[model samples]
Target: MKKKTKKSFIEYGVIIAIFSGFYFTGLHTEVLGFLQRGILATGLMDPDFDKDSGHAVNTDYPEADFSMKLIDSKGENVAMEELKGKVIFINVWATWCPPCVAEMPGINKLFQDIDKDKTAFIMLSVDQDFQKAIDFNKRKGYDFEIYKSNGGIPSMFSSQSLPTTYVINSQGELVLTHMGMGDYNTNEFKEYLKELY
Candidate 1:
């Protein structure tokens, strides 16, 4: 019985030490995000958009709030109106949020698959320290056009979540608002965006 207890204690200590190492090195976020990415593979994290429902790009919501100010990677100020596309995919995220990190790969894939002329992908970083978001983007090589918030974010995109996705159609209508991590690189999603364009 004592031998078994000693073995259990040693196992627990090793586990704790490993976690402590991850935390101190600022790798805990990535580790946790990796675990959540596994969940994303199960197709459970895919956004809820029914193409057959005819409301895939919801036409019911109010106009999109394009009042938020942003700074580009080159430290240049960008106007919201400058982002011209048939459809706009705006995602609000932070580097430290595990779920945000988990959903980014799928988003990056979606960005690559879509037609740049028809769709604009805006990865808006809300990290308190903008440098962290910039560094994280560089390390991940997601190649997304990431921006940091320069001023107050509009209320329409506001949510009680770390990652919120707002889709806007050509008419500037806020079509869909998904408030969580999502697998957006599906053929159905591609077709849905194409149709809007």
Candidate 2:
């Protein structure tokens, strides 16, 4: 009877371990925010920064055209068409998203380095509370061109993900679509942007 009870305990332990693993992997809430911060600290959560694969160019999904009034921090309307002739980098994210917060610094750095005249960095906030987004950016001292989506978001730039990014070329062509956080401070990514600009 003692041996049978011991076997049952081991089986239950194994089951608990399996359940815990699955739970951790499935956790997308603030419960995993600490884990994400740790990963970022260790430089393990860099953006899947790529230039070769469907990122720098997409022949099929060319001409990414969209008309949306992106409201600036000063309550000014910034039309998407104003940036048509420039290489546009649009990041769809919210202030509350852990992955979005984690990847922002790299994006800010990229924005600082890129040619402002030739490239337009549009950080579209998906936040329900637009003030919170602006406040977060100000508190973080990030100088991204953060805007609120005031109209219909185009299919080429829309995603179910909280932190999706799309790169549109100078000719208003869709070049890349990144579904999550990425390390945007890479040399390869900069070079690709240079080529695009």
Candidate 1 per-residue lDDT over residues 1-197, each given as its tens digit: 99999999999999999999999999999999999999989998788764532235454557677777789777989877766546889999998899999999989999988889878888999888888898899999997789987777788877889799988776677767788898888888888787666
Local accuracy of candidate 2 as per-residue lDDT tens digits, 1-197: 99999999999999999768756764343445445656665655454544543334556656787687789987999999888878888999987788887778788989989999999988999888899889889988998768998887877677999788888777677777888777777777888887776
Please, what is the TM-score per model?
Answer: 0.92, 0.75
Q: Following a full C-alpha superposition, what root-mean-square deviation does model 1 have from the true structure?
A: 2.2
The lDDT for every candidate, in the order shown, is: 0.83, 0.78
lDDT of 1 at 169: 75
Which residue pairs of candidate 2 clash?
47-182, 47-183
Q: Which segments of model 2 are wrong by more than 4 Å?
A: 1-58
Q: Best TM-score goes to which candidate? A: 1
